[model samples]
Target: MDLFWRYGFATLPVLVFVSFYRMGDVLTLTLSHPLWNARGYSLEAISMADGAVALFASMAGVAIGGWIAARWRMGWALVIGALASAIGNWVFAWLWDTPLADGSLYLAAGIDQFGHGLAGAVFVVYLSMLVNPRYPAAQYAFLSGFAFLLPRLVAGASGTIQKVIGYDGFFVMSGALSLAAVILLPVVLRARSRPSDQPEPAA
Candidate 1:
């Protein structure tokens, strides 16, 4: 029940919201004229390339994250995902501006895609863990609602924030936020792992 509630109801919505917002932002950028110029690539070509990259990258991310989650606890998986996301964002924000070949962007895009994938997988696993088998339907519905709403609430401001900060600053901030998430993992895991009714299990 706890796992279901946490992951299914709580985490799913957040991940969905973030995914939607991220997709929208990427789409907007891919279609925008200025971004194309900034990248020294044609708008149509870049847009096409970006779309393709996002597709593959997200799929890959989800796969890897899911794999990791299956072997590890949700907290650990989330921690890893958060760290990867931070690193990817940092690279995108800082290193992306360097004069590199087109292949470089593709590689960077792949890394970002992997990060997102990992996040998605971790979220799914966590939510799954939260769902209680007894009241699966009700709990799932509750989680589903959050899955639908929170992203919009949190990610809605992303555009405005990005505008104010610019890509570099925004990436840095996002990375920092991700790191903060990572930092919380140990505390959360410790609490979760603490002995309950039964005496503490021998380590």
Candidate 2:
């Protein structure tokens, strides 16, 4: 109904953040093999670095992010995640050709995986807060669907974008995309924090 759509519309900023965030994620993930090959890395080395190390780092990040969000504000946690993701992407792209490039790549990949874990945890929290408690299941299902829906569509073009820009440029673009979430976070937080108006009790 219109109400459902309107409720979804109220969370437009979050949706925008999700779209940009996931698009960048998809781009990085989709092109990682090609990027590693270009960097003269063997498949086994790439698997060891990006697979095992990144996985463990991501688990740590998820735990740390969840702890921080529990201790501080979720909005601030999301900000931190965005900053980490952006910086990680920048590092990966910038250090791709310098000395110790393999080490640099591992470090950047770990940082990026951490950022992803953090952001993912915080995103679920955001959805929980946004959904109506009375209809938790239905509302969450609707909103959660909306969260990844547009992002999937936008991420479909990552191949074309990567082809046009190359790996370094693509990574930088991914980092740059996170800025939209940074700019919009404060607005979304403020809107979410506002209290609904209630009629005063009769004397």
Candidate 3:
């Protein structure tokens, strides 16, 4: 508690963003249902696109995310990662309306997985950045656990949300929700500086 406040990460906006960060990402679930039942895609095709292609795409994203975390401001990385994920969700919605061209399905799956990897990598780094240097293990455990706690619990409501909105609307909302993280970025960045960069008081 003392450390959280001293580090400037205990505020409502930061807490809210951390808790809900996974909401938009997870909404991209149920991929096989639409692909297999509605689109008539084969298991092999699904396996190829989601399993193999997605693995490579996600790896690429993770690599890029790592580079960005190393070089760039993490706030910008958050923006990039979140937008990629949100756009990935919207891509699925758009493709569902249009007849999927050959390879389009694979492309959509790849984008989603890539965004997942990017955002996930960036988020992990961000959490680590917030951990108190003196109490790395314990603080990180609390933060990491709290981060996913709400998102996982609220995940059950997704099916209900989908039932009401249908796929396209659901996906669009998912995209917008992810953008919420982007919107919160300024607040988070302003509230908390990196531990190493912790501002010193006037002499």
TM-score on alpha carbons, each prediction: 0.66, 0.81, 0.85
**Model 2 superposed RMSD (Cα):** 4.7
- Pairs that collide, model 3: none
lDDT of 1 by residue, 84-195 (tens): 7666666666434767456666666667667767765776666555455545677656655555354355555766776787766766666665555554444444433211
Clashes of 2: 0
Scored against the true structure, residue 120 in model 1 reaches a CA lDDT of: 59
Candidate 3 lDDT score at position 194: 36
Q: What is candidate 3's lDDT per residue for 1-203, written digit by digit as tens? A: 64556656446677788876766777676442453346666677778886888899999989988888788988888888888878878877876776756487788888888888888888889888777676689978887788777766665677787778877887888888787877787778877543454556578
Of 1 and 3, the candidate ranking higher by lDDT: 3
TM-score top scorer = 3
**lDDT tens digits by residue: candidate 2, 62-103:** 898788778878778878777766766666676565564567
Best by lDDT: 3
Q: Global lDDT of each model?
A: 0.58, 0.69, 0.75
- Which ranges of candidate 2 are over 4 A from the true structure? 1-9, 99-101, 192-203
For model 1, how big is the CA root-mean-square deviation? 7.5
Order of candidate numbers by TM-score, starting with the best: 3, 2, 1
